[model samples]
Target: MKRLAISLSALALCAAASAQVTITEPWVRGTVPQQKASGLFMRIDAEQHVRLLGGSSPVAGVVEVHEMAMQGEVMKMRALSHGLEIAKGHSLVLKPGGYHVMLMELKQQLKAGDRVSVTLTFEDVASKQRFTREVQAPVTALGGAQPAPAAHHRH
Candidate 1:
């Protein structure tokens, strides 16, 4: 009984530690059955300045942090090669036509109401502190989600 209690206490501590970086309103865009890729959006709030290193999921073979912005009249999309930084007390929102998580080589299609399990990795900018958090996001309609397309963005 003591061993069980200790194990449960340890699990609780781990849950609290993993929640240091709060993930809110997490969601993945709906994709066609044949689509191979999709986008994920969420808001991250941290107590200290931190960098979003990267993330992954069982649904996709590759996951990357990406950005979408306007280059003159054309829309440009690319990976955030060095990761994205979130300042202390500031919430970093990942949405379409902005900073978002790109899921490539998806193993299956995602529809409305579906849940996605995502693991987000983070690193403290000041102390190089590292941690990861798991998020369960529900899929929403194609145009129903917030943080839609925008023009012009600077790194």
Candidate 2:
């Protein structure tokens, strides 16, 4: 039937959309007992041009994509309201002191060695199709993946 064919076609499209993006090295920064916020880091690879719309996690009341930059003599952090773009075949690295996921209003403390679930949403640049990928990010110590001193310091 025509309806069955159409349904199968739509299912194929959905599968393709979800397969175009891949995530690796996903992690969330460990937070102190009373800390209300933390950061999540990961590497995203795109097989097609897409935009990272943002993400959500049950552990945090609010989740957003943020960028940290040096504005003159002071460092500034701001959310990327328009989302981030990734070219086809390229990758985006979400790391500390750069682009990362801000997890605010935590429901509980995220300690090292724990895992959290984060669902990232993305939109295909050409077709405007949207999809989501759920990733399990391990909680690493605050000093886990810093720049030079990252490996040396651990609590």
Candidate 3:
């Protein structure tokens, strides 16, 4: 009976760990034929403070977390040197023209209605517990959420 109690306790702990965060609306843009790069977006609701370290997928040779920002007249997109922090009781949104996952050197093209698997690594800031959540993202077309176009045509 003591062993049974211990086993159940372990199972409960594992469930709690996985339940602290909820990832939703995971989607990737459909790439044109021969395109080697793409972006992935999603929403993460964290019950506890956590940092999104990185992501990986077999479809892409390299995966990175990136942030897009307007630097003066230039639209610059760069990888986040530090992981993105999702505060406790808050939601972090990864969308176009903002923070997102970049998938480069694709092994195959993503088509509309298709799905790809990605693993997002995260770490709890306090206890340092780390875990990964596997997300299946559907391929979607460009939506109205894109940022406004640059007002000037630079030569």
Judged by TM-score, which candidate is best? 2
lDDT of 1 by residue, 1-155 (tens): 99999999878755655655778777888888889998888888877788898888999888889999999999999998889998888888898889999989999998877887878788767756567888787777655664234411111
Q: Write the per-residue lDDT of candidate 2 for residues 8-94, one digit (tens) a residue.
A: 999999899999998877888888898999998888999999999888889999888899999998989999998889999999999
User: For each candidate, how many residue pairs have backbone atoms clashing (under 3 Å)?
Assistant: 0, 0, 0
Descending-lDDT candidate ranking = 2, 3, 1
By lDDT, the best candidate is 2
TM-score of each: 0.80, 0.88, 0.81
Q: Estimate, for each residue in 44-155, the C-alpha lDDT of model 3 and write its tens digit.
A: 8999998888878999998889999999999899998778899999998899889999999999988766787888888888878777788887777543232223311111
Alpha carbon lDDT of residue 58, candidate 2?
93
Pull out the clashing pairs in model 3.
Answer: none
Any idea what lDDT model 1 has? 0.80
Candidate 2 Cα deviation (angstroms), residue 117: 0.5
Pick out the ten consecutive residues of candidate 2 with the lowest summed lDDT: 146-155
Residue 60 lDDT (model 3):
95
Error of 1 at 61 (Å): 0.8
